[model samples]
Target: MKALVLAGGSGTRLRPITHTSAKQLVPVANKPVLFYGLESIAAAGIREVGIVVGHSAEEIQSAVGAGDAFGLDTTYIRQEAPLGLAHAVLVSRDFLQDEDFVMYLGDNFIVGGITGLVDEFRRARPDAGILLTRVADPSAFGVAELGTTGRVCRLEEKPEQPRSDLALVGVYLFSPAVHRAVRAIKPSQRGELEITHALQWLIDEGYEVRSTVIDGYWKDTGNVSDMLEVNRTVLESLEPAVRGSVDTASQIIGRVRIEEGARVTGSRIVGPAIVGAGTVITHSYVGPYTSIAAGCRLLDSEIEYSIVLSGSAIQGVRRVEASLIGRNVDVTPAPAVPAAHRLVLGDHSKVQISA
Candidate 1:
């Protein structure tokens, strides 16, 4: 079996960040979210992979390259627009022809990886297999209704009145039979061909469809809170390693990883946290569940439960928590003389200011 990874879609939910960068490239634990899914697919032992890309195609292609680094020969299939998941498969037909493949959403994070699910699908050879997880808000996701025999009875895309809370997880396994299903369905009200509808088409036509209700952790890192939460969860299992310099004035505690060339001076870092390569943390209290990306600087500031992306700087800040700072961002103490607020924001940007 091969793999098809969807890295398309304009992440409107992520707003200003997605305006400049692809949502799939958003870093968690200092690694791009898309990398996690790719690593999982490589770990599943399905080498031949095809990545579906849209507006951020150049960036994604640059980061992933030929996929040699991930031990897979990848093919980049360009989607003309941000159509939808089913549209992605339709465009990737040339690469996925006549082969059973797994479709993994690039920005989704699954704790254990999909090796087991791929193995099961390969053995059973079902016409279609989907991963499902119970979600609190089924209306936000493509939901599935199961029959008495524990089979998927119906599927709906973001239904107002969901029949069940079993939301479809990003990963899906499918036989070549899905090619016909995609061609048979029409676009939903959203003007895009949803994957859920294609699955419903298969079910209505009596094609064998199966589902696995995963009990493990899974996240669609689409928004800020979800990204921060996923970062915290991944940090919880971080293996402690110090390949960088920690000065005599600094004190490191708990499961912290000070990556190579990073320097910590006169600071205290309480882990499940990471100071990325070449980053400098000085005279600060780096709290738990935080990840400072490579080439960053934090001085006389206290931060916890946040993610600071590459080349950013935080200096003389009182404290920051549960935040997502983007690349090349500079955070410093605001001038007291200018009591008034100043702002430059993009479309759909959200900001919370202290009154």
Candidate 2:
């Protein structure tokens, strides 16, 4: 079996940061989000993979080289536009060829990995199998209708009135039967061919469609809040290590991994946190659930539940929490300015100023 990882789309939700970098390349625990999906595919015994990339294709290509790092051979396919998910599959048809493949959204994080799901698919050999999770906001994702036997009866793409609370997770398994479904369906009202629609087509055509309700953690790291949440989840499982230099004044608590070349001094870091290689933390409070990437510096500041990207610095900042700081960015306190008061003394207007 092969794998098709979708790494395209302009991440407008993560503006300014996505403006400069690919969303899938955003780091969770100092590792690119895309790498997690790649590693999972490799673990599932899928060696040949095709990555569909769009807006930031060059950067994605450079970062994922030959995919050998993840123990998979990768082929990068360019999508000229950010079409819908079905369109991505249509474009990757040549690479996917007559093989059964798993489609993984690059920015999506599934905690337990897809090994079990792949194993089930290989055994059952359904025409299409979709991973589903119960979400409060079903309208935000593709909703599936299940039959009495728990088979997927229908699928809807972000419907205003969802029939069920089960939302489609980003991972999907499909046989070559999906190629015809992709060709049969026209673009939706949004002018893109949605994968949900393609699946609905498979169901309408009397093909067997299956669903797996995942209870494990799964998130689409498209926005800042989700990114931070994924970071926290990954850091919680970190092993304690100290490859870096730590001064006597520093205090490191549970589950902290200090990579080689990182230095800590006169600071207290509570763990389930990671200080990446070459990062320096001095006179700061590094709280739980924070991942400071390589080459960063944190001085005289306090940060918690945030992700500081590579080469960024948090110097003299009082506190930062639940933030996603981009690479090479400097976050320092603004210089103080003298306070002044001005009053618009208009006719019949009452004004008050504190002395």
Q: Which one wins on TM-score?
A: 2
Q: CA lDDT, every prediction?
A: 0.95, 0.94
Models, CA RMSD each = 5.3, 1.4
State, as a TM-score between 0 and 1, how close model 1 is to the true structure.
Answer: 0.95
TM-score of each: 0.95, 0.97
Error of 1 at 41 (Å): 0.6
Rate residue 38 of model 2 by lDDT: 94
- Name the runs in model 2 displaced over 4 angstroms: 343-355
lDDT (Cα, 0-100) at 345 in candidate 2: 83
Clashing pairs in 2: none
